[model samples]
Target: MPYIWLLPAMNKNIVLASTSTLYEGTYLDYLLPTIRELYQGVTEIIFIPYARPGGISHDDYTARATDFFATAGITVRGLHTFDNPATAIRNAAGFFTGGGNTFLLVKQLHTLQLMTALKQAVESGKPYLGTSAGSNIGGVNMQTTNDMPIVYPPSFDTMGLIPFNINPHYQDPIPGTKHMGETRETRIHEFHSQNAIPVVGLREGSWIRVKGNRITLEGALTARIFEQGKTPYELKTGAIIPF
Candidate 1:
């Protein structure tokens, strides 16, 4: 089944990326076209909005997402009406995950055992798209998420659709603002100390498109790869990393 899964894995199936959702603007110039291509058509997208880290209810999130899609004139709905989640993912032309707190998303995914069900959908050649926290779940694990893992995941095992970790909102070290316990550089350095996992720093407007092993960088500049014991290196346009 491993090799059997590899074929579809290498074929066109999933779209995992950070959120291009600017508050007042649409993601068309940044996000929608790639989704349209992945689904093989313009699809009526579904939003799963569970923010607030382990204590979120899906209502307000859903309402906000509905409004976002409605503005673009695409029929969008929340993945809540159906009690049977397998049925929910199975019936859809494509699945999109909106970003919030990745730790929260993973906690819910584990608690519900939706990981198995969602993985089944991806393996069957269905398109799966994740944004921000959504994209974080595509990696080997969510260890790199800026959010604290207040709730444990089903597994550190992410969707494994991608080999690297994603650090969305990849801002350079802030000079004077200190809100979280550690400085930006200190936090990332701590992450490096704990794991050797390669992390990809994605700026707000940037993303990567995985179309059958052709992992291409989009939006602007290049992706920064950070690892333990080694100096961070920059991978520019047309670089195909094994991870």
Candidate 2:
């Protein structure tokens, strides 16, 4: 039988995207429509750039997101610029967390004691968007992330906004290749060997949409699902994730 985990009653409005940029596309080019809908009626939002992709400064990362959201008539301010990030999160109309190194991002959030605050804010129905490493934090923990351990966090525990974890940027093995490296599925299976949490392998161009208590897969492609013991399966687009 397939595994099922019940989730708590929630008031979440979140978009956990697999990646920020798609092949041959500009930053956030593909998700602009979704962004408009997710943050509807909200003119301003806070951008969490703690991931700091490629070691870019917070200001630079924020600028990248700012430029992208501007097209949708929304303004973005970096969380690092505020006196108290936790306070800012509570006050912000919406939030967007850009992609980068998951380890570094988790460390900063934990070190600054803002994880719980952010979680509370989002749980209160504030619109929240996460891409790549940012989306990893939306899971039960960051253990399924595809990032190097460049920094250690106080704990692997994430916000647990969803009942299960997610493996962002999930890819399938090529039909015939001699590379012999461990596939993404292999790593996830190993995780199941020790952990019971279900994992959704979110492929590029796909995202998980959360509205209140309903969680659904969004995009044109199918998503791979993995449970502890059952054989992995594919979830079609627009289908509610069974957790």
Model 2: how large is the Cα RMSD against the reference? 4.1
Q: Report lDDT (CA) for all predictions.
A: 0.69, 0.93
Tens-place lDDT per residue, model 1, 1-243, is 679757876765666665547457665346666655676653476666644424556766666666655555556667765697667766766666777788778777777677767776666666777778888887878877777666666677777776778877776767676666665456667888888777888766677777766676676557677777777767785567546
* Model 2 lDDT at residue 55: 99
- Candidates in order, TM-scores: namely 0.82, 0.96
- Per-residue CA lDDT of model 2 for 1-243, tens digit only, reads 322222223568999999999999999999999999999999999999999999999999999999999999999999999998888988999999999999999999999999999888888888999999999999999999999999989999898889999899999987898988899999999999999999999999999999989999999899999999989999999999999
